[model samples]
Target: MTRSPVLELRGLSRRYGQTTVLNDIDVTIPEGSFTALLGASGCGKSTTLRIMAGLDRPSEGEVLLSGKDVSQKTTHQRNIAMVFQSYALYPHLTVFQNMALPLTMRHLSSLGRMPFVGAVAPGSSKARNLIAEKVGAAAEVLGLTDLLHRKPSSLSGGQKQRVALGRAMVRDPVLFLLDEPLSNLDARLRVKMRAELVALHRRTGRPFVYVTHDQSEAMAMADQIVVMIGGKVAQAGAPRDLYDRPASRDVATFIGHNAINLFQPADGMPGLHPAADEAVIGLRPEHLSPAATGALEANLETAEYLGSEIILALRSERGTEIRAIAPGDYAIPAPGSPVRLGFEPTRLHLFDEQTGKRLEVAS
Candidate 1:
């Protein structure tokens, strides 16, 4: 079934004085989909997310939520929950209290929020019970039930993140926005949290807009990735689509784990297709490897042995640096030895030499 769009940004642009931060941006987030706003630092991805969450307004554009124009709505009025890079938990409050804060503020009156007086304030007891139930349910889902009594200062990085997520979950907002939520964690913990977040998204069944500069995180977590560069959308599509058919030279270099090897006509490598005469060719390291009867020849500079594969760095005859992946079991020749690299003709990507845009060529 095709889900309708839950959020849309049309002709969005942000400017501060004479400087423009975002330019004519258009993005669509489908219902129940996890969409990642991916880009490098200072590329306006965070600004775009802020606009969507109603924390910031676009200098020119409309933000639509479920088909209604919400450009002027406040963050509270949008019914959206946001989790920042910082855990943003209260140091003085226990996990349970932190998780319950949003519910108490929304459901209880100001007079009913006083510490001791709140207990006897009119209708406070009922709201407290409701808040407890919601907070408990959210904590259970996040596996924080046993640690609910601990303060933020006493929790590990991952635990504090979970508490933050629990707070957001209790709100049951129409949408969830996370801004680099895992960047602060250790590498191993970041991977673990990525899976947990995916599970949480599945359970909530609500749309998620995640802002991240890490391409690997975006590829692993999001169903849709919007790549922004220079304050404009460079490309937006599925992970496989972006990897297999990058719209431009910049995206090809950014989306892959190992930087892609780019060869210009001036390098003068042999056996290139006639189409390569006026175009720049890109080949991913994984798709290019050492073969006995390879078409391109280079001298091995170094080799890095990962558990599953060996990354071979080499310099071509024209001094173009290239990276290739070899099977873990493959025997590596000594450094400075000549190596022949081979790749499938179909794996080649051609880009215009002058404009850097991808060019389609017959395989």
Candidate 2:
């Protein structure tokens, strides 16, 4: 039996004056799973994350956590820990101080929170010890044990990021919200953090909702990915499922390693009968190869050699640019020289040009 979602957005929406940023968006995140919301800028990915974080309110629909409605609750009321892209750490505070913020604030009253006044406040000692223990535990997990005395100004980008995560971790929330948490890092750091973040998620066994525009990053980090477009979920599924069986042309192009070769029916080939509703054909570069008796003839515009494979760029008679990938040793005609590209009919995908949606071909 399927378990209830740990986080669910039911017909969620957001609007600005005459424009609708999101339209009836619905998504569910399972417990102990990593879910990434991916899309280009202005596609409502950030807005969706804001709404889920309770930093922004939805114009309509419900935000449910573990099957209960939380649309009306504030961030403080919900058992969620959110880490922003900016890290949001205090420049003057040490790692230990920052990680203990949530717990300290929760247990101490306003007057008891003052530097000197809090020392003698009733129950302050007990709370301080508790906060210290929590902070120490979190710092250990984040490998910040030795740097607990260091402030944000002295920490590296990745260290500061881990500090921010440590602060969230001290809260021990069931749900984790990360908004492009690694986008500010360098390419090498981003790659390193991807593996670390995934390992952290697995170790903690908590539900995580991540937001990112980079499809490759999302595919690498998320157990389930939600592709957003115009404020809606264009597609959602496992990384491999989305890559191998994209439901629409937009998704096919968005989630792959390279641009998918799209062909219209007007540029027909023998033995392939596109259905009446099929207006476009989508083929990945790997599925296409140079053949002696290939159906389509095109010029080799360029050859890109990557260690194990070579990507060939071709321009057909109808002026369509197509990309095909084959073994590095495959012979390629010089630029402007004619060549034939071939593929199995079953490997081609049919889509509707007007709707940009995939069309089902009878098996």
Worst 10 residues of 2 by lDDT: 269-278
Cα RMSD for candidates in order: 1.5, 1.8
**Where does candidate 1 clash, by residue pair?**
none
lDDT of 2 by residue, 1-363 (tens): 175588899999899888999999999999888999999989999899889888899999999988889888887679688998999998888888888888887878887799899899998988888889888898998899999998899999999999989988898887899999999999999999999899989888898999999999999889899999888899999999888878899899898888898777666543344462347878898988888887778889999989799999988777878899878888767799998777887777778878988887665
Candidate 1 RMSD to the real structure: 1.5
Q: Please give the distance, in angstroms, between residue 127's alpha carbon in candidate 1 and its true position after superposition.
A: 1.4
**Model 1 collision count:** 0
- Residue-wise lDDT of candidate 1 within 41-139, one digit each (tens)? 999999999999999989998999999999889887889999989989999999999999989889999999988988899999899889999998998
List candidate 2 stretches off by more than 4 Å. 268-273, 276-278
- 331 Cα displacement, candidate 2 (Å): 2.4
TM-score of each: 0.96, 0.95
Please state the error at residue 50 of candidate 1 in Å.
1.0
